[model samples]
Target: MCDAAETRPGIDPDRLSFTIALQTAADQIVNASNITGSDRGIAKAVLADPLPARRPRISARKVKCPMSRYGTTPHETRPLTSRSLTHLDITVLAAAEQPAVLPPSPANTDRRSRVFRLLAAADPGQDWTARQIADALEIGHLRSLSAQMGQWITQKFLVREGRGRYRLHPQWAKTPGDSLDSTTTIPA
Candidate 1:
């Protein structure tokens, strides 16, 4: 005869049927032998079907995230509430309170001011690339200074001379006395 425990793939038979069969077999073996105490308890517990391994009867808790339905977007971004903001502020303050090896210094301030002064002094007719400017000013970081030059161009303090070249705005470079039209009336 074919074994009763044999199972076909994709077809799950009744689990209780297998549990009853195991319990009956265990009971028969127990009655025929001198099984007692812990051994008998284990045999009974195994066949008792406490938390069956094959199909766990877990009732899963479902969570719902807030979503928008108006087609503005699938999900709307929720801003941090005041309580969460306070918690974030506290975390940031705690981190900031820790002793840091590198404290804020004004090291780059002088260098940047010097760079602006050099650019301001440059001839309006002339253009200087980042390397030429860096070499003239003895500044080592060409890339960073070039980025600063681009910012100056944006601010209208300098003009881009094309091909990564920069020149101070002609009007910016001119002194009050150097103006072509020196005739001016002062308002009293």
Candidate 2:
């Protein structure tokens, strides 16, 4: 059941809600201490403070343009003036500079290319350890390079002659369709 006398025009709903929240906080502070002499007095003073009145609501139509007070319309435009060449300076320099070299292709800098270059430059009978290859190519991770070298040997890209040494696959060094192992020469 609703009471018709409960609502009051002087008491705003927003102010009532704010008062309720403040009352709850005050209650907590007052009940927290058993010796509530000074603390209770402070909470009481806080709760007794008058609630702020609800701000006046402005409708879109009722809102005044801020620019109207200045007696000037918002964003007034002015005509642009033509530019005049009052001062000018110029300089010329020789164009004998060397042409910029193109950056190396991604393939040329890849791990496969590095490995191929290293092996191709080695003597036919010479074998390279993983550390040697890594050191020559400035690769920091030895173990990882060693693993990749092993994989290359398994893929027949390189030959694993011994424990750590590797050589370019003999077939790659030989001419196409030439399977003779004795005739295969070292790559230039």
Candidate 3:
């Protein structure tokens, strides 16, 4: 049975089954009343000898990163440098002092503006749901959406395709200068 290990080239010396068997057999006689201390010491020495060929070596490499402060408010600590600095926190800004100017005709305004952009991007006669517009424009209030959307419908810039769906009036899509923003005009 033990000669099996002689055929295996990479046999483990610490195999639990073999080690436990050898330890159990040796513990009985090695610590027996008849065995002398010198005999026990010799047995222990033979069992404790390390059987491995050599120890493994280790290697390492260095890494570098920009020495910058993380988690510090950039405005408070770092100078603004990148093109990504264009995002302004408009939430805290004051409302405009003057009343917003309405478009020259009842046909153009914010609601119409948003609708025109959305409809212009859709298929020539494709219907779009109000829900789709709300999501696209990030509209939160239904009343505002209704009022805004109603302005476009009333102005004939957009037409209901049915089931609360709408499409840009074909003529409105073709018109080059039919802008919807109030008090805003393209230079050309």
Candidate 4:
């Protein structure tokens, strides 16, 4: 029977054999002239009862290490939080609206500088998503740019406007020829 099933298209021999074995075992147990009447009754009850309906199994391929800077695990939807902007946030937003000159010389060559220059040169009140910045800078990997953006945020070179949106920090919105070092502070 299993050999015939194997020759047929879309039929698995192993599955057919297992089903036959299971049915034979069940028949033997239920029909056996066993010693215990209780065991027979239990087996009859189980056989008579319909099996519960089962959900179909689903399979998905998932990455072990997600490239996103936001979270370690993959998520279908991310929760958006709403909060009132603080004094500093408002100041940064207002300052970000002002146009600033790009840093000179070798500063334009590095990844960080290129990002800063793009954000700095953006039109008033314009913010950039990681993908947008990556596209603008011709960066191949948005994840790499996002990671660098996170670092820039920590270094006070950029301010996060909203989820995945970034703008130049108010502190760094200075005139031309100023040192681009993260440590240097301009007095308000």
TM-score of 1: 0.36
| Per-model lDDT | 0.54, 0.60, 0.55, 0.60
* Number of the candidate with higher lDDT, 3 or 4: 4
Kindly list the per-residue Cα lDDT of model 2 for residues 83-120, writing each as its tens digit.
46689888888889899999886435567667776676
TM-score of 3: 0.34
Candidate 3 residue-wise lDDT, 1-188, digit = tens: 13333334444333324554456457767667435443443234334443554343232211133453222322343333333455676667777799888758553445556566666765666788888888887878867776766676777767878868778777766355454354544121
Model 3 / residue 109 / CA error / Å: 8.9
The segments of candidate 4 whose C-alpha lies over 4 angstroms from its true place after superposition are 1-107, 174-188
Candidate 4 residue-wise lDDT at 19:
48
Clashing residue pairs, backbone N/CA/C < 3 A, model 2: none
Task: Tell me the TM-score of each prediction against the true structure.
Answer: 0.36, 0.37, 0.34, 0.37
Could you tell me how far off, in angstroms, the CA of residue 73 lies in candidate 2 after the best superposition?
Answer: 66
Using alpha carbons, what is the TM-score of model 2? 0.37
Q: Model 1 segments beyond 4 Å from truth?
A: 1-109, 176-188
RMSD of 3: 24.3
Candidate 1: C-alpha lDDT: 0.54
Worst 10 residues of 4 by lDDT: 69-78
Best by lDDT: 4
